[model samples]
Target: MNKKYNIMLLLLLIIISPISYTYNNDFIIRTSVDMKYAFCDVKTNGVSGANNRSSVSRGGIGFGSTSTNSMILMENGENTITIELASLNWFSQDDIPQKERNIFHPNARCEIVVNKMDDQGNIIPLTQLMVKINEDGQPEAYENNKIDSSIEKKIILASNTEKIESDKILERVNAKEYPKDMTVFQFNKKINISDLPKWPWVEADKYEDTPKQRELLQAAYLELWTAFEQQDDSKIKQLLTPSLEVWAASTGGNVEEQFASREIGESFSKQNFQMIPINWNNFQPLIMNNGKMVKLVYKEDFDFSPVSYRFTTEKGTSRVAYHSPIFSFVNGKFIPVI
Candidate 1:
């Protein structure tokens, strides 16, 4: 009787063991990209919007946001299971200094990491997307806002950092001689008046430049001049916007190639002499029909030091001041349109 009972118990154990094992193995989990890429639709100010909406140009990830996780219900050939995956952190413009922000600022690569559980609390990566993101402008998800118009009203510099109307500032710039001894940043901070072009809903209201716009311009000015002084073609190109045509009328030549040539030429020339930026004194803002659209004029004087002048060596001397290129402010960036 005891042997018979033991045999029956052993049979029951074998049957239950197989059933449990098959239940656990019925479904498998793996990570993959949601070809639909659905999470990129959240829109906020500070990125992209041509139609009067401002977007912060978040490459793809949220600016200053961290990697995140989510779960998706997936179906395999014969089973369905919930899979956990992570959104890996990508690059963001916020990583760079504010003054150095560019269109390709910060973005994360598109990837999905499938996580599997080993121990109750231990998770391991099992699968992931192998594709890399091509960094460029903001992703298409957030590019919906249409900028109402690109036509900006004329910008006029005020004699002082005082609150003044646009017309008053224009009159001031016309009436007074150029201010001296001001740096580019200082020049940008000075009072300026700007107006919106004639809109149907309202007559253009004249107002002092917004604090944010001033700050943006100052940062752009510093970055641009620094890039020029250092003759960094990559940095300069990153900071400026590309023109619509090979020959941009605003810049008077092929924009990218022109800048590249100038920077490269300076590099070769720098072997013999060093050009130092003294100050960016004069500031004039204009609206143009050419690609530059928005324009600012400033005078820059350089100190020329002879590393190996053709003649006898002499102390560094100040080069005559010249007006800078007509820089355009587009999509919150500064580029030499002229």
Candidate 2:
């Protein structure tokens, strides 16, 4: 066999081999509000698992659907792996609050099947390794069996690994191969507001920003940054209106901060500005221009624009000054009006 074939064959055997493991729901599903995606991380064995390991495989559970499709295969032989739900981030239509993105609710159970695959794609399950987290990045394990106040407190205070060891994994077995043709066991539980973290951004719901508004902001935020990074003037123009485009071109400002510029396109091309997505939670809503428009003031951490050739010359500068970009809500979309 050729080198390519040999490599492929080796991988298939190592990941496809089937092995049975005791099903244990030792971990709780934790939701991260800070992430741009609806992300769930796995923690077990006193170790917080990462979602991008080679041993972890991921797939989605559709509504009324009996089987799930496996999209990724992780490294073999590891006892734990984390599966990130890339597809389950807040849907534009789902209307989930932007601040509550980290909260797991009963409205929909985002089921992710993590398969431990051997070289040949055979499988073993490590459900006990699956734990859900609250907004605090802490695990919320199931405590249905015990009602003691102290036990509850202990369970609450117990380390992620400790809480897992004492828990039992309820098996939801199907004859079909999991990930390839797995059965839907259960959806994630809806966490109470009192159970979530006390983050300041969690209160963003008090404002008039609707879920659609936030979703638009998310799309616009990503689009704006991508355009800025690629220096795609046409896309930037498309994202903003004629009035706003002129303003952006004439006035300099980073999405995170504000400043002055003569030509936005020329400034970037000359300085080779690089835009990166760092934080999205550092934003607030404000009414600007005497109620003619609403502005979303994302904190300075949302993205930072810096010169790509800073090493070559100290003269290179970004478009932004000290103030952040103000996205105006116009015609149902956020544009670079400010």
lDDT top scorer: 2
User: TM-scores of all models?
Assistant: 0.27, 0.28
Instruction: Estimate candidate 2's RMSD in Å.
Output: 23.3
Backbone clashes, each candidate: 21, 44
Summarize candidate 1's per-residue lDDT along 164-242 as a digit string, tens digits.
Answer: 3322212222111222211110000011111211111011122224566545545555664455467555654554433
Task: After superposing candidate 2 on the true structure, give the runs of residues whose Cα lies further than 4 Å from its correct spot.
Answer: 1-207, 244-262, 270-272, 289-292, 298-325
**lDDT score at residue 213, model 2, on the 0-100 scale:** 75
Q: What overall lDDT, based on C-alpha atoms, would model 2 receive against the true structure?
A: 0.29
Q: In model 1, where do residues sit more than 4 Å from their true spots?
A: 1-208, 244-264, 271-323
Clashes of 1: 21
Q: Could you give me the TM-score of model 2 versus the true structure?
A: 0.28
- Assess candidate 1 and give its lDDT: 0.26
